[model samples]
Target: MVAEDDEINRMLTHHQLLDTGLVLEFAENGKVAVEKARANRYQLIMMDIQMPEMDGIYATKAIRLLPGYAEIPIIAMTANVFSQDRQVCLDAGINDHLPKPVRTEYLYDTLLKWLEK
Candidate 1:
């Protein structure tokens, strides 16, 4: 699953993830991401931090409160690459952080790290 507000970024991510053989779902903002996440089962969630309606940190926290989602890996995807930003994600219950524009190798490796167990 991916939560991203930018259409171009979402499309790019979709193309990059096509080879992973995972069924991808998308949300335009954090609010929709939370709703979709609650309604479906996803192996991993790639979340954009700057989305409107709700930010990724808040969305991750909200998702963490949902039944069966506490252990799910929610990785923050954002242009914010500073250590402080990464710590913020971790504090918000995100399992990992990925800097954008997302590199295919990193994205693939991150997904494998969380989903291939």
Candidate 2:
């Protein structure tokens, strides 16, 4: 699943993932992301750190507390390249972190890393 507030980001990621033979769903904000994660199981979750209503960290924390989501890999995606922000994401239950503008190869690599492990 992809959770992003940016229309272009969500659309691009969804299309890229879809074309790669990976089924995907999108949420416009953290609120919607929580709902989607609770309702379905995803192979991976790509989270935008800065988002409306509930930010990615909070959403990830909440998702981790939800039943059956304990082991799902949640990777943080953000334009903020600061080390502090990246560390905070890891502290908030993100299994990994990816800086945006995500390259196609890197995105696929992140997916493969989690699934392969």
Candidate 3:
């Protein structure tokens, strides 16, 4: 599942990830992301950090408290490139961080790293 507020970024990620042959679902904001995550089982979640209504950090924390979600890999996708921002994602229980605009190769590699395991 991908939780992103921007349509263009979401579409781009969708296209980039299609080649992996994994079924994908999208959420337009962090609030929706948390709801979908709680109601469904996903192998991985691509979370946008700076979203409206909740933000990825809060969403991730909320999801972490849900049943069977503790082990799920939640990767943070954000424009904030600071070391402190990455640390915040880690503190929020995000498994990894991917900075935007996410490059196709890097995105693929990141997904592969989590999904393949």
lDDT scores in order: 0.92, 0.89, 0.93
Candidate 3 per-residue lDDT, tens place, 36-101, comes to: 988999999999999999899999999999999998999999999899999999999999999998
Please list all clashing residue pairs in model 3, or write none if there are none: none
> Candidate 1, residues 1-117: lDDT per residue as tens digits?
899999999999999988768899999999999999889988889999999999999999999999899999999999999999999999999998999989999988998898976
Q: What does candidate 2's lDDT look like per residue over 22-64, in tens digits?
A: 7778888899999998899887889999999999999999999
Best by lDDT: 3
Per-residue lDDT, model 1, residue 10, is 92
Each prediction's TM-score versus the true structure: 0.97, 0.94, 0.97
Q: List the residue pairs that clash in candidate 2.
A: none
Error of 2 at 90 (Å): 0.3
Candidate 2, 82: how far from true, in Å? 1.4
Candidate 1 residue spans exceeding 4 A from truth:
none
Pick out the ten consecutive residues of candidate 3 with the lowest summed lDDT: 13-22
lDDT of 3: 0.93
